[model samples]
Target: MAAPHDVPSAAQLVAAVRDFLADDVLPAVEGRVRFHTRVAINVLGMVEREIELGPAQAAEHERRLAGLGVADDAELAAAVREGRFDDSALVEALRDAVGAKLEVANPGYLGDG
Candidate 1:
């Protein structure tokens, strides 16, 4: 059977390929081949997560930047340097942003999880 018309999206495709490598390829290989296959699987996993989480993360990031009165990271940094925003607010915003990134990059490192 094929994927439904709306099924197997970009994230799904990446996840399917990642699963293929992990389940079918990883165990079938050894040594350097195994190592590289593992890396490919890890990278594909990250890609899948990014596909699923990137849009929401981006929107949240943009909102954070807007709240800080900046267009982008560079502007945010400039604002920080100029002390244009509340220090506590800026720190909270940055920490929240980092946590959101860790959510996609690796939730385990986010501490609160």
Candidate 2:
């Protein structure tokens, strides 16, 4: 008995479809609509993912900064508005804030790190 090869693999079909969409369909489309649509869809997907995870991430960051005994939210907010954290302690505070955010919000989301 021999294995049949009538069907294409999913990866092969997807690649073929993408190539067709890009080289044939997209080029035939008028104006910047297609280009903008593609960008908008991509950005919307990213925003959706961020919205789902941003809050927990922010909370974790706040907790870490609080642990570091850094300045309160009002102070951080003011510094951010002024476009600088300035001091080394402040920088470390920001680092810890971000690290904790990533750690909790996406722990294991980074893959083996």
Candidate 3:
């Protein structure tokens, strides 16, 4: 006997299946490879997202700062790497970069909503 809230929804079941594909299926195929393969895959996915979004975000920051006219690519790159950009600029940059990169869409990212 379970409460209504305790029941797993269809979305949760689907999510569990998706997690299994990533955490179990992919790693299992590597055969004798250690768990580090899965770990590496996960890390690589994160890096890919960063690469896709990071530049566009920086470009947006540069665009916004077109008003202040203090934007430079080299300085922006340095700031991004060192994480020293102004707060608003950083947020805008990240949003733009992520939006741009996300356009291509990754297959591994299994979600519709």
The number of clashing residue pairs in each candidate reads 0, 0, 3
Candidate with the greatest lDDT versus the true structure: 1
In order of appearance, the predictions have TM-scores of 0.86, 0.41, 0.31
The deviation in Å at residue 54 for candidate 3 is 4.3
lDDT of 2: 0.59
Q: In model 2, which regions exceed 4 Å deviation?
A: 1-31, 70-74, 77-113
Pitting candidate 1 against candidate 2, the one with the higher TM-score is 1
* Whole-model Cα lDDT of every candidate shown, in order: 0.87, 0.59, 0.57
Model 2, 82-111: lDDT tens digits are 766557766777766656555534545555
Better of 1 and 3 by lDDT: 1
Who is ahead in lDDT, 1 or 2?
1
Candidate 1 stretches greater than 4 Å from native: 1-5
Worst 10 residues of 3 by lDDT: 104-113
Instruction: Give candidate 1's error at residue 27 in angstroms.
Output: 0.7
lDDT of 1 at 16: 92
Writing each residue's lDDT as its tens digit, candidate 3 over 8-60 gives 64435444555665778776676545455566555555555554555666666
Q: Give the distance in Å from residue 66's predicted Cα in candidate 1 to where it truly belongs.
A: 0.8
Order of all candidates by lDDT, from best down to worst? Answer: 1, 2, 3
